[model samples]
Target: MRVRDVRAYPHRVTAQLFSLEALGWDDSWRELASAYDGCGDPGRIVRVDRGLFGVATREGLVRASLGGAVLDALAKDAGAAPCTGDWCVVREWCDGPVTVEAVLPRRTAVTRAEAGGTSRGQVLAANIDVAAVVVALHPEPRLARVERLLAIAWASGARPMVVLTKADLVMDADLIAEDVRVVAPGVEVICCSTVSRRGIERLGAMSGEGRTIGLLGASGHGKSSLVNALAGAEVLAVERIRADGKGRHTSVRRELVLTPGGGSVIDTPGLRGVGLQQAETGLSSAFPDIVALAQQCHFADCGHEDEPRCAVLEAVGEGRLAVRRLDSWRALRREAASMGTRSAARRRRALGKRPRRLATRQRETRRGVGR
Candidate 1:
């Protein structure tokens, strides 16, 4: 769909109308959503407001509230809430209310530890094919932040790519990109500048034919601008970076935008703090250099501390690896492990309450019999 076509429409929902197939609907989704056939139409979540959702379906886009069942599921699991990029069943009542009945299982989900010191995790985006970790070149790139985002992206079960934005602001963009490539082994790193329109085509190509690309990064990184450039129109709002190089929070919500080539991009609010959640696999993927070295250690369970014949420590001592890199690995590893522990403890507590509940039920049954 072209931006011009959308602009001509009188209503936003009607302008964004697209078939389920164009929105990345497939046979697999059909099978998963089969149980909901009689309940409603299949749609993709385009935007999520406080408690309302903008869902795009074959009929068009509609504002829908959460169904009773969906709300109940979210109460137990915050991650279960419908988010941008989710495919779901949308039901409309005759009285003029629409509700999202259920969300189909996600094929890929970018998640991070819930903010504010909680064990519960939040799903940043769902059913994505590519996770683009965006980093700004101004004020120099934060390699540590890149590494962290990569771990979260890798854990999302989607191919990860690095997008270096604001390339035009810095003259050493290529050098920075190469440095990033060194840390991101086996990942593609592209320098993009919305000003020069550099690398926009390459990034745009990532989305097409129902494929979804998700943008992940901190604020002031130009994610919204990138989405506008890719969509060939201003589909999202953009704000100028502050004098201190910090970005103003312009995109207050996460939204899925469709491009002219029939692909989708999910733009999320710039992340301030991204803690790891069950990202052991992502850590390994992000720090393959460390993982490869640990393989040759004397002990299979080498902690890479002061263990004898520790290849990892040797690499650090010999300057083959950055000590900071190793420290990053250890820190993220501990955080992820801590999350696992907390989750296990919560599960045990829940299980422990089950017996008490069952006993109460039995007592109630006995009283009924006595009556």
Candidate 2:
């Protein structure tokens, strides 16, 4: 965007405005901001309160609402919605508060199924570079959850990293991280202790300048702690969990927290319903080994179950792949596929037409879901 457009409405500038770079402002954003031609300021959303948003810009932090133009875009695609970590144009707007004219193109986005089984995708964060899947070591890492999260991270078009947190509370942190690493084909697995500060620097180094990392995990996974450790301050609050080891939801919404250094980190509340969207490419990335092995199956469309010369089954038999990992991968694949089926059905319903194979394919989807 043009410098004048970014500085639009110069009277609105305030001390609360944070450095643009800290919020991931760069040349790419300048180009998008230029579209406004001195009508609005380029801003990154830090928090969304109620239906309004709190954006950080060269003019400082301003509370804004979505304009009609962007709202129309959201009607067509959920990805176009203004989400935390999104860089948007904050217009002086018409009669009300400063409005977000439009959301610039996002390089990466983290999306999950909208809760309530609506088949709608809910974007958690946008324009992130790295996705840090934090798993605490105290209760042991759940590979199934890791695999599930990895699928989302992979689908976001960001580099996925597995961080095993609270390492000081566990005896086999490294071993557990290794187990997680087995499922993380091209991902990095780091065992970290927010208390002991283990792997803190390495994780901090992952963020700086224009780079933005997204932290995602279940509640009590120490996502807040890791963010605090990385920022060297208590930016996000944390809560003590129950004696039974279950964690209470602390963060109520997704927020973008800028590190003291540079770059930004988007923290999302614990996800109880971590559903995968149309993430076929994500499944392949998360389970590259399994996808590669499946390529060698005797049949071109082998399901890897009771099929002759099933490379996947043979690998499991030879202990080349963990049965549990493979199971989790299959589960995610099935869940993703089933979700796609449902999504397609919903789209067809919206169009007021029924496909000939809809019911048959749905039955098959149900039968294959738990297999």
Candidate 3:
């Protein structure tokens, strides 16, 4: 495989590879892309495990570890990590192990709040063009959850689509479609069933040639099953949720699989709880209807709790909107804003510590001189 061949995968990957090459890569891939000029192999990270990553290079699949300079760059830029779909530069020597020297810039990245109530954003997939938010029909579909996922999908700097799984199990597809429309109004909503193969063809068309789509949903939502069905083979493992309807983490890692017709899909582990970190823009965009209503509120900073002429409350009272949807939006908005503030504070403290330590060192030097 060659560097030019690897660049043909997708727009995001192609752009990143070209950008790195234009910047003149050398021994180290720094922010400015100046590195030691030598032979560099291009690859996309498929999975990261035990401090090693599975990179699909032009030469073939190879396991590689990050070099010292790359690790230092990651430490400087917290957002820079080897995520699935990221186009990276690798050094492969026959006599030694391969090392990831640099990760190219991403055109689009899907990020969400860490599920553990952490004030940090978790990059789910990088350099993806589309995000297919999957939801199952079993155990009663939660529209609120769908809305939440849509918000994150939109925030990821990628196009968002809703994929309703297990459509064959539900008797009335129209009803489910109506419920989904409330949250993802203009976005495409696909109904599919692995058993019946309903809407599979349409789903394939939406992905387009050479584009990458990411699958995201809670466990038992049939994400892996859908991936297997689309691939026409059992590339991913499938497992049944518990009797109580809770899903087990069958897909332990995120991987990109090629589709038979065209394009690729990334299947990730089922997310139990999705947090809203650094997604304020995505939240407002996902629920534009609610945001527009809030704009008409009497107070500019109204909490919508007991504000006078609250347009949001008025709409809910008039049956134009669901109360639960508004509640969910408010909850997520507050959480996202709070998380952003906390993260900013932490960064400030960390930065402040460095200056304080420097000042202390200067004082100690003066004291030593006086003594």
Top candidate when judged by lDDT against the true structure: 1
lDDT of each: 0.89, 0.84, 0.77
Q: Model 3 lDDT vs. the true structure?
A: 0.77
Give the TM-score comparing model 1 with the true structure, all chains together: 0.90
Residues 73-167, model 3: lDDT tens digits: 88887677788888777886655577888887877778776766767767888767788899987655888899889888888888999999998
**What ranking emerges by TM-score with the best candidate at the front?**
1, 2, 3
Cα error, residue 227 of model 1, in Å, equals 0.5
What total of clashing residue pairs does each candidate reach?
Answer: 0, 7, 4
Q: Which stretches of candidate 3 lie over 4 Å from their true place?
A: 1-39, 240-245, 355-371
The reply for model 1, stretches above 4 Å from the true place, is 1-12, 241-245, 354-371
Candidate 2 lDDT, 154-227, residue by residue in tens:
99998999888899998888888877887788889998988889999888888888788899999888898888
User: To one decimal, what is the Cα RMSD in angstroms of model 1 from the true structure?
Assistant: 4.2
lDDT of 1 by residue, 138-171 (tens): 8798788889999999999999999999999999
Give the CA lDDT, 0 to 100, for residue 197 in model 3.
97
Q: Model 3, 173: alpha-carbon shift in Å?
A: 2.6
